[model samples]
Target chain A: MHEYSVVRSLLRQVQEIARSNGGGAIETIRLAIGEFSGVECTLVELAFRDLAPEKIGRQAKLEIQNIPLEAKCENCQQNIIITNYQFCCPRCNSQQVRITAGDELTIIDIELREVGVNA
Target chain B: MNQTITVNRDLKADLKEQANRFRQRMSDQGTLVVNLVSSPGAGKTSLLQRTATKIGDEYRLAVLVGDLATDRDAERLKPYVPVQQLTTGGACHLEIPLVESGYERLNQSDLDILFIENVGNLVCPASHDLGEYLRVTLLSVTEGDDKPGKYPKMFRTSQAMVITKSDLLPYVPFDVSSAVEDARRIQPELDFLTTSSQTLAGVDEWCEFLVRQLRKIQK
Candidate 1:
């Protein structure tokens, strides 16, 4: 699947952020992938488990957070969270809506152990 | 000791920012780059072949085709217009870096249009922008009518959808209207055209739409 490539980009971004923050050995990689983003989660986890680079993040744990698809109801004037791929407003039953979230693929944070600090 | 750092980074946003820069450069030169996506054997190449023939006299058209192997698509389109192929080795989708390199290889000036036939995929390519001003996603009639609802990401992001192989509608159970309606539900503003390159069914209307869009963008 394309999750392998997505993981490569994620790993590259994680390395850059880790490098800026003292270049320590990483322990955890926190990420957020949206439901509407078209990325399969299980495949991403599989890729991370197999492909996380040894030098920078051999022991890093992958934590992927799911972001539900949320839309702004123009008629209801409120934010409605969608669970079943429906874009209609849950409260007002209006079809006119704009997506607010659940289309993001971002690395939120990381936890790292300083080189030789624990051992 | 473990240090927790809250460094939020939007990776797709970063790629899109770069894609926007590439798109802007093409816009500056009055060229429209359209990223075409579809499942394999969904008539992307045939549609382009028809498009090149119908409008080849009116515009200087060139195509860059991406596939995992072989320059076959490029060769297929060579009889019509300028063609370049980007062999991705094994990647499912063509990303910005490969697209940038392919664009350089085309090496034309003042061209009226450029078409990028993305690696034959409906899912992964939905995430990669490739610096296109417009995206046209194709769903062949044989692929079934409910694909739009099943795979909404491609339909959601695409500005237009082509129901290809309309000639097979007589033999297949694909409900053209239902497919169009499904796509419209995902993208209310999406334009739909039913086409069969074999019969030249809707090629003119498709080409006309492209010309209209090109004119609108140029003005």
Candidate 2:
């Protein structure tokens, strides 16, 4: 699936972050995946399991947080959590709504062992 | 010591930035890039054939068709316009790099429109931005009307939905109004067009829409 490629990209970003911070051994990689981001979390974990060994070591664990779609209605000016993938505003039933959050695959943080530190 | 680093970065940010820059460059060059996405056999090639027949004389059009193996799509469109086929080998979707390389292969300037016909998969293609000014998703009548609700991300990310094979409506159970309603719930502002590439029905409106989009960017 495309999750393999996505994980590849994620690991590359993680590798950069780890390298910039003293090139530590990655322990945990936390990700925030929105419901509408077109990514499957389980597939991402599966891909990471298969690919992470060489990139971030075998012991590295993945932690993914599911984010609900959030949008702001332009006409009603109400913040709403979208359900059933509906993009309309709930309060005023206005179709003029803009997505404010929950549509991205974001790397929130990473836990790693410091390069010179003992295990 | 175990150290926690706060990165808070989107994985696709760099790729998206590159795509944005590419889109800006295309806009500056007066080329309207349209990314056509759909499931396999959803009439993307058929629609392109009709579009070329309808508007080829008026606009300079070229196409970059992505598929897993064959250059068949490119071959099909060559009679009407300049075309390049991107064979992904095993990749399910087209990325920015492939698109850029395809454009380079085309090597044509003074183009009015450049259509990137993405690999035929609804799920994966929606996640990748390929530097297009417009993203149009196609759904044929045979795919059923519930597709939009099931594939929310694909419908949500698209700017327009083209219901292809409209001539098959009588025999199929697909309802056009219900399909549009389902998609609109997810997209809210998505433009809708129905076309039967076989009979060339609604192809004129599709070309007109492209013309309007071109004018908008040119201004």
Candidate 3:
């Protein structure tokens, strides 16, 4: 799956950040993966486990947040919560609308063990 | 003591930061980045070969080809100018950081056009932002006309659509006009182009359009 590539980028970014922060080793990587982002969490975890250790983030723990899709109806301007990809107006059944949220894959922050502070 | 918790937030801020940095870098270097999306066997490589031959010397062109494995595309594109094949290593899509790195690897030169051939998938590739000036999605004549309507995101996100393998149009059931019309219904400003690598039909127009966009970025 594409999860392997996503993890590779995730690992690269996390390691860069960690390396930038005085070359400290990273212990955690937090990711916000939205439901509509089309990425499965279990697969991401599996990818991280397989790929992360080979890079600069050899011992990092992965943290993933699943975001739900949200959209607003164009006709009635109703804010509707969605679990899937369809963005339809509940009031008028209008398909003309925009996605408000839920499609995101990013590393928000990382936990690190300060250099020379730990064995 | 240890505890468990949930961290949640949409990456609005993160994406914004990435976008800002990307826009600044692209604008500073006058780089016209085009992310080419399509299904496997949609003739993206063939189209690139034709395009590079048409306008290779006139512009500072480079390509970042993505695939599950191999440097074959890069090797093929070498004689033209510069080509970097990014092996996704079993990944389906290219992300922003990788593109940024690819830019650096290209020596941050004054590129008139940078073609990023994304992994051949019509769905998820449309969702991720690769920081392109224009997004072009391709559908070959053999892939059926219903693809535009079926995968609305790819059509909606792209600024243009290319129907490749037009040489086979006579034998195929593809209705080029209807497919273009369908894409326009979903995205009003989406431009459509058709080409056949074998016959070299419509290839000039495609190169001209790309050259025009690259020139616009330069100005």
Candidate 4:
């Protein structure tokens, strides 16, 4: 349900970024989606595929890179690598941990052809 | 030669910034904003109505209700306080703009507290901070005892986990203690309250809690 909202914002950013750059035909939009971003990547991809054709970046390709979660234990100060949402510290079995990675939702870069540029 | 525009923008972080601005505004106005989230039919409105009955006059209170459509909840709550409904049309969660606009419409100069009842959902609402001084997530017994474990996102983020519909405990197999235990495991500092809207058993207690929070803010 919220995937639509996510796509709408993404598209808005795409247009704004393109406009700021004096306009461009967005060739590829790259995104880094973290594991704990609370957004379903498949849903976002579906939204982009459905809505983009009628709006900005009609032929833009969406490339997503999934970021795995990493946490720092509050007790032992150890960096614990997570795989399947097991948040507890592996060494000390402490639950007090701060998530350091894999919760971001950010656009990395956009490959675009500048206006009045030859193919 | 080719060019790669390095423009990195984060939307979720932007939402957090918006929510922080709202919080600062509320703090400057000396108003306590509390956001309530729950599943559909989890007794959020009923509890609010019951609280209104018990202590509606104790403070200057206003409500902003969000749903997909309809002002039905607003109508139910109008008698007690200034209630406004925000129909999202189809958005599962109420974002910062909708909430800010709704509160701005109230225009109550001396309002003491504002309650924003989020669109009934456990998943979507948990992620969006509506600049609430307090965030409460409700769970009814009929929904089952494993809700906290199954949906940890809502429980993990909430300041308090309210167990509503306690009157149905006898008819249903919901364990109040176990539910509290499960939620506390995820959030050890989380406050727990057992309430029954029909009986109004915990209504006064919850009302008192709000009054206390309001008074704390004033001091």
Candidate 5:
């Protein structure tokens, strides 16, 4: 559903980057999809594969990096890993916490072919 | 030759930079921007209508309403204050670029507060930054109390969490304290208020809170 829209925006960014950097055909685009980013990576990849080829990144490959959830505890002042959507502090059992990472979506890298050069 | 490369590191950093730039530019003119985020039917437009009605004349208020289609919300708020309907054209969130362009289109000489009602989706809008000084997210009582846990990013990113449609509390089984507590679990200092446009319950206090935020930015 919303994954399609995410793909569209991702492709738009890729296209802009490819065009601006001397009109090179995109080879691979690396993206990081955080666990809580609310974007489904599988659906995003599917849509990107379906759509990017029609645009400037025809031969482009998509590399997705999975980001895990990380949180900090309020009571123990300790860092705990949220493995299974369990946000409470492991030691203190305090629900007061903060999500330090794992909710992100961005184009971290783009593999671009040199203009007028073939590989 | 095809070689792989990495680009941006921190998406939130980039977004924060863009937002700060916008804030600096607007600060020079003493204008405060409020970015409103919520799910569909969460009473965002209704809240805007109430705010406009209550405090439109006090400040030079203008709104940029975002939606996938139709300027109906803009039209509804137009009579009260200046409004621009930005059709995202199927995009679920309003990015900095679009908001920048929308601000240009507004072309106002002096605006005390500019409210941008983002596309009615909690998931996407929570991730995108629109360069507003204040980010207020609303969760209606009718939508249940688990929204804070279900959509943690919205509550995490927003400066204030507004629980809308409190008048329906008697009919619905939503627990207000549970929702508030859930939101606080995500962000300890997150400010929130509950209100219903129908009963005028806490509407005045909500409006006052918004005004206080604007005034803080002005000072």
Candidate 6:
């Protein structure tokens, strides 16, 4: 799976952010993963577990939020929660639906312990 | 002390931006980049072989073929066009960096078209954009008609779907219309074309499609 590579990118971004914020010990990484993002949450967590300990520390945890596939119909302007990967609008049966959300892997926020805070 | 940092960012945003920049650069050079993706053995190289024979004389074309290992595809298209192979070394997808390096190796800036034959996997390739002007997904007749519905992400992200191995349609259970219908459900404006590189059927139409895309970019 490509989740390992994706996690590597995620860790790189996290490391950059941590470094910019005074080189703290990363504690929690918050992420939002969409249903249609072509990523498996379990696989991502597995990859994170395998790769994060050495880079981000052993206690760092991933908090993942699963986002459902949602779209807006261009014809009738009806908001829809897509089911079974059907992209057609349910209200108007319009095929001209545009995805409003649920197609991304976003890093929402992160919690870090400031370096030398306990020192 | 514990501190929280709000860093709202899409993971792929940087990659997408890079792809867009590449697209603009290629557009300025009058190069139509076509990313061809499909399952392994879905006639990607075969179609390219036919495409090279059909339009290689009319256009300055090059190919960057991605595979886990092996330069066999590049060898297949060598007689027809300038070809480079980007071996991912086990990666399931061809990312932007790989595409850029492959393009540099091709070393032809005045190309009319650059075709990237992506690594043969429908899933991961759909997630990574290779700065292509046109993203075409190929479905061989032997792969069944229900693939569009099953692999929704791949079909949804693609602009066009090429039904390959049309010569084997009678032998296989693939219903072209049903596959098109299913794909169109996810992508209403998706274009569809059927061809067989073996029989050379619809090869001219495919070449014309590329020509039309090139003209669009030129204008």
- Point to the candidate with the largest DockQ: 6
Compute the lDDT for candidate 4: 0.84
| lDDT string, candidate 1, B159-181, tens digits | 99999998999999999888888
Q: What is the DockQ of the complex in model 3? A: 0.16
* Candidates' chain A TM-scores: 0.90, 0.93, 0.88, 0.91, 0.92, 0.96
Worst lDDT 10-window in candidate 3 chain A: A82-91
DockQ of each candidate relative to the true complex: 0.74, 0.80, 0.16, 0.59, 0.48, 0.86
| Distance from true location, Cα of A4 in model 3, Å | 5.5
Candidate 6 displacement at residue B127 in angstroms: 0.3
- Candidate 6 chain A — worst ten consecutive residues by lDDT sum? A110-119
TM-score of chain B of each: 0.97, 0.97, 0.92, 0.95, 0.93, 0.98
The docking category that best describes candidate 2 is high
A1-119 in candidate 3: lDDT tens per residue?
A: 56776677677666666667767777776888876676779999998889877785466788787777777877889888753344456677776767776677766777777777753
Best candidate per lDDT, number?
6
Assess each prediction's global lDDT (C-alpha) against the native: 0.87, 0.92, 0.79, 0.84, 0.83, 0.94
Candidate 5 local Cα displacement, residue B188, angstroms: 2.3
Q: List the candidates ranked by lDDT, beginning with the highest.
A: 6, 2, 1, 4, 5, 3
Whole-model alpha-carbon lDDT for candidate 6: 0.94
Ranked candidates (TM-score, high to low): 6, 2, 1, 4, 5, 3
Candidate 3 lDDT, B73-176, residue by residue in tens: 77877877688878877768787777777777888477888899899999878877877889999999999987887886788779999999999999999999
Question: Which runs of model 5 end up more than 4 angstroms from their true locations?
Answer: A1-26, A56-59, A72-77, A83-88, A92-99, A106-119, B6-17
lDDT of 6 at B70: 87
Q: For candidate 6, what is the DockQ-based docking class?
A: high
**Residues B126-194, model 5: lDDT tens digits:** 777787888899999999998887887678778898999998999999999999888887756789899
Candidates 2 and 4 compared: the better one by lDDT is 2
TM-scores vs. true structure, each candidate: 0.95, 0.96, 0.72, 0.94, 0.85, 0.98
Q: How far in Å is the alpha carbon of A46 misplaced in model 5?
A: 1.0
Query: 4 or 5: which has the higher TM-score?
Result: 4
Candidate 1: residue A87 Cα off by (Å): 2.5
Interface RMSD of each: 1.4, 1.4, 5.6, 2.1, 3.3, 1.0
